[model samples]
Target: MRLNKTQYVALHLLMIFTFPSYPPYLIVAYYKPELVACSIPSAFQGQAQIKWSKAMITVNVLTIIPYALTALIIRSRKTSSFSRRLFRSLLLVMIFDVGSWLAAVSFIKLL
Candidate 1:
């Protein structure tokens, strides 16, 4: 099944709004332990900060690029079985993406 232009536009809009912005925030929370009230010993904090920053940057780039590409593909006029499958996969990914962020945020708040 192929989506109409309006559906395409709507999907892209939804994706733009729903994509995760948590990796950067996670990076901050991990590095600035004060933000999340982490009580780690001072000796390892510097190493932890470096590791978190690197991991966050890597994951953020990885997640964001595919997200942008998926949005672009959804917006295009090309309709094929592959595109449909890709669109469904993207939708599922977005669902998981949003769910994961919400879960993490709640978990952090509870900590």
Candidate 2:
């Protein structure tokens, strides 16, 4: 699959947005439940909490939108080479997402 420049950028952006801090968040939630839970209600917990949550939601949503769009683009039986490459790239992103999540879970469990 030969991804065009736009598709390559899109896929890289999706991967960046999806997985960067996800594992750390998962680990924190697992190991520091009280702190994570309290931060949600503690308005004065400072700007970091607010910023992190906002970024997390925005990036996750952005990642999902592209993947869904790619799926639809592929399912429509579009025959463009670029679309095919985009579809394959999106599939790899999906796989990487799952693998990252699993690795996070395993690491948390091992601790």
Candidate 3:
């Protein structure tokens, strides 16, 4: 199903909320225990608010296209080779990278 601009907007907003795989925060939490406080890490200087927005913007801008494709593939009825190829690749990532499991489910739910 082709998404019109409004659908695309909705999809993107949904994706933005879902796509920031937990690894980054987890790493910071586990490895940098000192930074565990909600306060911004001094090294990451400047306001916490801007940093959060930047991370969200960076993740969505970089990943939205591939993620959209993944969602489309999951939602599609066809069993095309391209879909198999793309999904298989994603499955491989999902297999190797534990962090991606949530993303895989989120994409599936986009249908």
Residue by residue across 1-111, what tens digits does model 3's lDDT show? Answer: 999999999998987676555435544543532443342233232354345545644654555567667767677867778877887787666445544544643454353
lDDT scores of the candidates, listed in order: 0.60, 0.61, 0.55
Query: lDDT tens digits, residues 1-111, model 2?
Result: 999999999998997787766545644553432443332323223444455546655665566777778688677976788878877887787768856754653554355
User: Against the true structure, what is each candidate's TM-score?
Assistant: 0.37, 0.36, 0.28
* Model 1 deviation from native, Cα RMSD in Å: 12.4
lDDT per residue (tens digit) for residues 1-111 in model 1: 999999999998986665445444444555643433543222124455455445544655566677778667667866777877877887777668866765664565366
**Residue-level lDDT for 102 in candidate 2:** 49
Of the two candidates 1 and 2, the one with more favorable lDDT, higher being better, is 2
Query: What clash count goes with each model?
Result: 0, 0, 0
Q: Candidate 3 regions off by >4 Å?
A: 1-42, 48-53, 56-65, 73-77, 91-111
Model 2 clash pairs?
A: none
Worst 10 residues of 3 by lDDT: 37-46
Q: How accurate is candidate 1 locally (lDDT)?
A: 0.60
Candidate number achieving the greatest TM-score relative to the actual structure: 1
Ranking by TM-score: 1, 2, 3
Candidate 3 to truth, TM: 0.28
